[model samples]
Target: MGNGDNCNPNWKDASFSYYKYVPSLAAAGIFTGFFFLAFAGHSFRMIKARAWFLIEVLGFAGRAVSANQEPGCWTQPPYLVQTLFILLAPALFAASVYMTLGRIIEVVDGEKYAIIKRRWLTKIFVCGDIVCFLLLGGGGGMLASAKTNKSAFDLGNNIIIGGLVLQLLWFGLFVVITLLFHRRMMLSPTARSYQPDIKWRSYLHALYVASALIIVRNIFRLIEYCQGSNGYLMTTEVFVYCLDALPMFLVVAWFLWKYPGEISGLLRRKELYDGSMHEI
Candidate 1:
């Protein structure tokens, strides 16, 4: 293809160009399947209410991929709507991660094994998540609505960065908590005894992978937005697919493969928590 061909909006033979977008489309399709699995699992009461929320958010994220594709082709209104949903969806997933981790910590013996109180796990992290979501959504909406207003776009991106930073900080703290809990579990027989079953540990490991993937994606987003809309990262497809889309696809896919509903059921049946355990 010539330089002019690169700038062409339409072409008779563009089959090769379509291959570049397969990753995004594949991610969308995979998550669509994951959504159905989540629904089926939840409908049969195999998964808990918390897991249902995770599945619903994955559906939104999967839809965002479709919305995000060919942004240049979308009209102003459609583009704005897409931007809002795409930015908002992942933040919600990060929030759901907090909820997932909270539930896992409860199973792990929150007060005894974890560094922090179990009661505050969801409260603090999820509330922080809400604040981050509002900032990102509000800022994204402002930028999308601003059209050609450069200053407003910059302000909006800055707001998004602020939200991303907060999320990073929260994830960092949670990582520390996870490490401490793991260490305690290894050292204390009581904490290890509270461990549900092998499958439950695998479920927790899946969550750890999910959390790490989301955190990495958030960091990339933070850097991308910090560079502004005109930056290379914003204009590139590879970065978006590798840094953002791939991580999310893996997170949901991993969870679906591990089948959290079954694992949680096993944990419940194992009776890891006596009646005296504090409710999260």
Candidate 2:
């Protein structure tokens, strides 16, 4: 259509009106950080036990980015702190994930989870996560560069599909594996301390919610990508806000405070949560 405008692809089309709502958005970021902190913190035990913790953390970190919205909303005071929370979120989520998986493999022995122990699976996971991280990072960079050059949007929009697909695939596989584990456990009665399929499904449901939010926001990139190369996707500020910023924050907090660890000691008992065949 018209010539591309200069702005970061990250903020989408957030403009002067975006400024009007900056305070409100920043406030929401504060609440989101606190709410997620509990999820992130309380998940420590599960993180320790599971090999896929990094994937979970990155999923949440992406949500935290949604919470940040834009710098216009976080110019000063509490907003700055909130902004820091938003900015630092993805990295922390990544670190937590890395640490969680590494800890599980190291402490319990990687062989414990045969599925995870597969060299092929590990390679696939590592590659997929790297791609997913790069895609999200590219989006963030484009958003930042949007403050300067208009062309960076091209790279940002292009990388998203590959990343989203890989991320979603990994998450789907994760849900399936968890579901299978639950089904097996259900067939046996010895798993008294194990987290029932309910709790496992509940956690998976929460993770899916987070992934779905990011997936929705990322879809804007695809729309922009399809508009013809070198097209500016951020120009559609209305749709971006409605689809990406607004709805992306609608993650359910109900399960955060009441999960396997807090509600049941399943996360606390590593072997119990391991498999249906027997406790690890």
Candidate 3:
């Protein structure tokens, strides 16, 4: 551990230096506000879809508070709170994405075209997400509390990297399943797929955009963690905002612009469709 004079716990006593540069209050505040708008603007019909926005709101709100503290002060609670929340928020975002695809399949009555059975689609991806979430959340907590213990810190970092790898694999498979379903639907279109009001294509496009952004951000994080605390990514502050925060913000914006509630509405209207669909 490094030495410090007056701080409660010497800054050097922390596992890692908290921030290379002071986090920007303005950026954190803007992100928090937008996420709050997303959470509040969603309709009652969109309750399920709106869950992740609340996580983002809390995550960025913690970040906003962390931004006001002295740089490199790892002793504060907000530092750990913001770090863990921000680290884990994307898993929730990906959960909504998984459910959205299942809803989209239902909306188009394209269960037959889906690579995975519609019943299993959300279940499979969400189970994987839950595992990833636990690893990430657990690993983050362990890392945060592992102050001055190099062995504990390395173990936690490895666990986080494992979680990230699992997430990437699951997400990549999800995209493949989505693309295959899209292609099959195009080749043998269902009657519901052609309905003018449903706009399943638009929603699929939005999912593609959101998935791409999340994947890119995850890759950036994977690299950041792999590089370790003293590495270039950790020493630089801009990458966090540029790669992680900005991508997530755009994801929320894209979904807000192309809301997924239509899928839920259509599914509600044709409740029988989900149960009775024939599999090929």
The number of the candidate with the highest lDDT is 3
Local distance difference test values of all predictions, in order: 0.63, 0.42, 0.82
Query: Deviation in angstroms for 187 in model 1?
Result: 1.0
Clashing pairs in 1: none
* TM-scores for the candidates: 0.73, 0.48, 0.88
State which candidate, 1 or 3, has the greater lDDT.
3
Task: Compose the digit string of candidate 3's lDDT tens values, residues 75-123.
Answer: 5466678878889988988999999999888877788888789899999
For residue 116, give model 1's deviation from the true position in Å: 1.2
| Candidate 2 per-residue lDDT over residues 93-129, each given as its tens digit | 3323223332223223333343554344445555666
Considering TM-score, which of the candidate structures 1 and 2 is the better prediction for this target?
A: 1
Order of candidate numbers by lDDT, starting with the best: 3, 1, 2
Which lDDT value does model 2 have at 115?
55
Question: For candidate 1, lDDT tens digit of each residue in 1-280?
Answer: 1233223253223321211222355555555565556556546554253354344434445445544545223334434544665566667677666666666665555457866777887788888889988998888878767655768867887898998898889888877887787677667645435544644366567768888898889989998888766566775657866787667667666666765655455447547455436553
Error of 1 at 180 (Å): 0.7
